[model samples]
Target: MSFKYRFAYYLVGFVLGSFFVAAVLTGKDTRCNYFPNARVLNDLRNKPFEYSKEASTVLAENWIDTTDIKNTLTYGDVDFDKSNIKFENGKIYIVEGKTVKNQAIELKVINYTSKAVLKEIKKK
Candidate 1:
């Protein structure tokens, strides 16, 4: 139509397009756990059961046997001593040992988003 009208319409379209693009880019969704670098995921996957101080405490308190702890690494459904489990910063700490008096192995789950433990699967 008129030059002034065309200019106004173009300006409005540009503003609206910018807003749409910003919304799409800024919207939150499930982010890949391997953020900043994918190598962290590889590292975590390679050794998911590394011990931490808290993990050690949980394991020692929970009476999870060493063999059972190892089984958890490969098996999906190793029974966890819930009393010895704790969660922090999207990671799960599981303590496994034969008894409270024995040394407990710490099982750390990397990149765990949810606090709930997934059902353990039997070892094949």
Candidate 2:
């Protein structure tokens, strides 16, 4: 077979394989949450969240709101070194991100079975 013919066959196979994979994964939430940070953040995002008194107070004082908190959780970096993953009640995760106004913020969240509790919030 000529080089051109072989190249055409390979290109066709690649395109077909790509299409097959895309069709199989279309309309599906096939997100890869394999890493600890991604898995923890995804788990926390899925569950409903409650704010503690301290957290709420910080939010109000800093001109931040629940929306900002939610955004931070959705796009924050978890500080595993400062988090207590083996707490007796539940795992506590410290997530650091910025507010909508570009103000830096940090959130301490405790993950429970049913819901997550925003234990603390601070402007950083």
Candidate 3:
């Protein structure tokens, strides 16, 4: 085939292939979390989340509700340096994120799991 014809054919095929891939993956839960922090946070979010009395009390005192904590976990930055895994109770992670209102906050989530708890969230 002529060069012009070949280029046109290649361009059309490329566009069609791109469209097919997008269409097939539309609305699918496709995510690529390559960073260590992102992978950790994503894994945590996928698991069940729970809270403790002390965590609730601290959250309430700091004007942070359950919803805020959920938002933070869903869209937060995990500070590995601030996380203390050698706690007597459970492993703790310091998660930082902004609220829906754009207010910045820090959270200390204790991963003390039982038959009921997955993660305990508190204000950092």
For every model shown, what is its TM-score relative to the native structure? 0.27, 0.82, 0.70
Summarize candidate 3's per-residue lDDT along 36-71 as a digit string, tens digits. Answer: 778767766776776667675666664666677678
- Candidate 2, residues 6-116, lDDT tens digits: the string is 999999999999999999999698998888888888889999878899887777774797888888888899998998686667899999998889999899899988899
Least accurate stretch of 10 residues (summed lDDT) in model 1?
Answer: 115-124
What is the TM-score of candidate 2?
Answer: 0.82
Clashes of 2: 0
Over 14-58, each residue of candidate 1 has an lDDT whose tens digit, in order, gives 999999988997886534544422333333335534444554555
Find the candidate with the highest TM-score and give its number: 2
Stretches > 4 Å off in candidate 3:
59-62, 84-90, 98-104, 112-124
Query: What is candidate 3's local distance difference test score?
Result: 0.70
- Give every collision pair in model 1: 59-95, 64-96, 64-97, 65-97, 76-120, 76-121, 77-120, 77-121
Residue 34 lDDT (model 2): 87
Pairs of colliding residues, candidate 2: none
